[model samples]
Target: MSQALARLPGLGPRSARRAVLYLMKKRENALRPLLSALQTVAEKLSTCSICGNVDTSDPCSICTDPRRDEKSLCVVEEVSDLWALDRSRLFPGRYHVLGGRLSALDGVRPEDLTIDQLVRRVSAGGIDEVVLAMNATLEGQTTAHYVAERLEGFPIRLSQLAHGLPVGGELDYLDEGTLAQALRARRPIA
Candidate 1:
């Protein structure tokens, strides 16, 4: 169990062992529900066809919802970023998940992302704005710039999330509220 849990993102061997021990102590309550929830998520979760967001439904609840602003789109590097933005409750627009950034070292390219689909959505869906909510890392900025270049002369306003500090990335680690503030203070990328 320790080895299995150690494979997770943040859990080291020691943390995994501690977590496993805790789970063992709460086997009937926490452990069972956790196992069941993991199984359910693994079985049910799928990529949304429109935006690449993970959902039980193909189009995703956000894409289908009439309350969401169809004219504005937020482009993000991953579904995790989308969730972070959604948690802020500041955006009313829809989203496009790129899955990952362009990394020549890793052989990740523009074609590998959902850029073509995003362009199609912008052109065909009457989109007015595209907020680039990608990470603030070097690769993230490169990817965002590439997207902006591709969407040039498309009659859409392109913007990017602010830079300075990040809440999630370990700049010695940060708090969620600080991240939210950074997002809110985001400026357009020239």
Candidate 2:
């Protein structure tokens, strides 16, 4: 049980053991529901074909929603980043999940990600703005720049999230008002 629980991210041996014990103590109410939820997700969850977001459907609700701005697409390094941006509640455009960032050391290349699909989506038409919401990490910035360069000739406005501090990342260690000021004073990437 500990081994099984430890397989989850952020759960070590000690934490897993504690979690397993807790679940065992609440077998009927907590454990059963947890197992059922896991099984349901395993059976129903699938990657969205158009944007690579997790969904039960292929194109996903965002892609199929007629109210979403088709002309604006926000490119994110991962589905987690997409979720974070969604939590911010500032964006109303569609999203493109890249899966991962470019990292030569890690053998993650441009082809390994959904770069080609993004280019195809933009080239196909209707896209006017692309907001790169990649992390502030080196690999994230590299990937963002690469995408911006690839879309240079296309008639689209490319932008990025304001950099300074955040509520979650390492920058989150900073004060709240500082992060807000950084967001307000964000500049366009040259």
Candidate 3:
């Protein structure tokens, strides 16, 4: 159990061991509930066929929601990114998960992602905007560029997430690339 916990992200062997010991001590309160929850999730969890979001249903709650804006789509590199954006309740549109970014070193290619599915979704009409909410990494940028190229001439506005300083960030602590992007994307204050 410790080894399995250690294999999870951000959990070291020592931490996993401590967690196992704690769970052992609180088996009735923690372990049983955790095991039951895990079993339920394993039994009911499924991937959304349209957007690739994981949920209890095949289409996912977001995809099936009638109140969601169908004319706007937010394309993200992973389901986690989609969840993060949705939790903010800012974008009222649907989403498309690319599964991963384009990384030549990691052998991730356009074909490996759901780019074709995205193109098909756009080609089907009603989508007016596609927000490429990829990460600032090189692979993410490459994937965004590639997807933009694929989505060319689709009569949809292709946009990207602005790369700049964070909400409460100190400029002095930022990297050169972020500063450059912030400068390039500078806008007149309204």
Per-candidate Cα RMSD to the true structure, in Å, reads 5.9, 4.6, 1.2
- Candidate 3's clash total is 0
Backbone clash pairs for candidate 3 read: none
Each model's total of backbone clashes: 1, 0, 0
In candidate 3, what are the lDDT values of residues 19-84, reduced to their tens digit? Answer: 999999999999999999999999999999999999999999999999999999999999999999
Model 1, span 1-190: residue lDDT tens: 8999999999899999999999999999999999999999999999999999999888899999999999999999999999999998789999999999999989999999999998888878589999998887679989999999989889888998766564447644776665666677777899
Per-residue lDDT of model 2, residues 66-147, tens digit only: 8888899999988888888878767898999999999999999999999999999999998999999888779999999999
**For candidate 2, what is the TM-score?**
0.85
Q: State in Å the error of residue 39, model 2.
A: 1.2
lDDT values for all models: 0.90, 0.89, 0.94
Q: Which structure is stronger by TM-score: 1 or 3?
A: 3
* TM values, all candidates: 0.80, 0.85, 0.95
Model 2: how far is 166 from its true place, Å? 5.5
